[model samples]
Target: MMKRLAMVFVGLMLIVGNAWAVPDGIWKNITGAPAYSFYMQTYVGNAMLVIVAPNTETFWVFLDADDNYTNGFSASQDLSGAPNSLSITFTSDGSALANMTLTGQLPATYNLSRNAQAPSTGDSGDAPTLISPADGETIAVPTSASPYSMTWTAVTGAEGYIVQICTDNSCTNVISDDNGDWTSTGTSISLTHATAGFDFYWRVRADLGGGSYSPWSEIRRFHVSSS
Candidate 1:
């Protein structure tokens, strides 16, 4: 006696070894991107050699690192559809690559219309912010106890502020340049560094991000215990 058996295959939903893929040739389409993904349908066929399988379908798709498609399968795709091109984007990790995959197998020797411009930039990242005008007080100049003061324009995006003063023309000099004689006052930015009898140039810029620095201020000038 003969016996009957059943079998199962699954997902990616890919048909494999059966679906016809267009040769790696150049297909063309218009270029640009909308806020989200877009679609285009081009003939994926040879016309002379094969006919689309009855009730068969074709798709163009992209995938992610997890093998998930960026855009899903399209329904009612026809070999005669026009503007067979599109644009898309993906994450850096490729975990979300935009694609154009076709299903319902195409006729052998068919073509996949491709957009001249592949996908470009992904969704915009988190909004940026400005952080500092910072906290400080008692910014002094032309004094012995302390010397060095800086003022910055008001900031809007800034969450807070940071003020730095130095006795040198070049700002490359850090806190060490401020010397042991220094102080801060939070809201209104200011500082005083002990550098008696020396002419020091200074300036301040508002930092507009959470702990980020703003563009440096025009180098302002001042003196410590004046010459």
Candidate 2:
């Protein structure tokens, strides 16, 4: 039997323009392994690529544009701390090709076709409820102490949760955000980079997979005071 390998490759590309040749949405593999798919979305003036695979390690990379070009982009990074690289190209047509090279494996190409437009918003009722460090709550932090714990009520049928901490109530300035690897199945996470004497706003959303996410929970604020 052949070995089955799964992985999610997420790349953040900083580009200069509001237009893109490739549509932003979920792209399914038309040729090659049935497990390969890509989800592209534009966030905060950057393009984000999300590869969804089951029981796989997640890889993230930041790619800098090499030239003033549109319609296609490529990036190389180590997957799961392995010596592997991937290059993807998109065409004017609703199609894409991904070339991947993995250690001790033959190079392969996967053909992808546009599936659907990226989701704009998720169901509000599926949103997770914030639990810990309650709204307007004050927490004293010592110079040497464990990270602040942020907990929330889990949502049924949710594969994972995304926590975003911002500097404003409107969540325009996001300072910290974590998706918990999409398989953690945990309802809480620790904010290790929280600074003292500052107000932080946070919210939680459920990741329903297939490029769909639940609406963000109500914004909550907390204060971190120096001990």
Candidate 3:
């Protein structure tokens, strides 16, 4: 009886351990764009989720319980001022299906694949150089009549580039858009509208593919005039 009880205890422990297993690392959406991704991490026994939208808006969700993962996890948070909920189920170690819902919008589903390598900041020498809307230049508000163009010097081996516009000098508060993150295979991107009467900062980075990216270019600041 003693031996049988020990075996049962060991089996229960194994089941409990497997039940607590959660997916970690970066998972990118395979189905569509604007590209969406999630970065799952655990720190000090706390589970954290970072959601990246096509427009480069990042939403961080903190899970309340460690027991949230039972072959999958679910969470909800306010993202970009909208109430958003996310549910993910692991189909395999390398694949998952995510169901997301945002207030006032249709619920959407995504097929995800784990990146073989997580993205890390690459050498600054490989970063792109900002060209137009020169640092500190004030410009008329972007409009159809006066659309503003942003340009950057191309990197030699770059497959693409990412442009981020922010409202702060530090570039933490990125400007949000519905089209997706500003990614281009070319050197320039045009903007039709940006909030007028505010200072804006911009930067560029080269996308080298396979989860590799160059360090951001030196940030540049510009102001948009309401007139």
On residues 1-227, what C-alpha lDDT tens digit does candidate 2 reach at each position? 11112223454333211122322444544443422233333232353434443211111111112211133333354333345454444333323332232222234444444444533221323678899989999976623356777899988768888777888998888774354321236898766656888998988887766444566789999999865
TM-score of each: 0.31, 0.46, 0.49
- For candidate 3, list the clashing residue pairs, or say none: 54-180, 54-181, 55-180, 55-181
CA shift of 105, model 3, Å = 34
List the candidate 1 regions with Cα displacement exceeding 4 Å.
Answer: 1-150, 176-187, 190-192, 210-213
Give candidate 3 regions above 4 Å deviation. Answer: 1-125
**Model 3: how large is the Cα RMSD against the reference?**
11.3
Model 1: per-residue lDDT, tens digit, 33-95? Answer: 111122223222211111112111222232222222223223343334333331222112222
Best-fitting candidate, scored by TM-score: 3
Best-fitting candidate, scored by lDDT: 3
What's model 2's overall lDDT? 0.51
lDDT of 2 at 110: 47
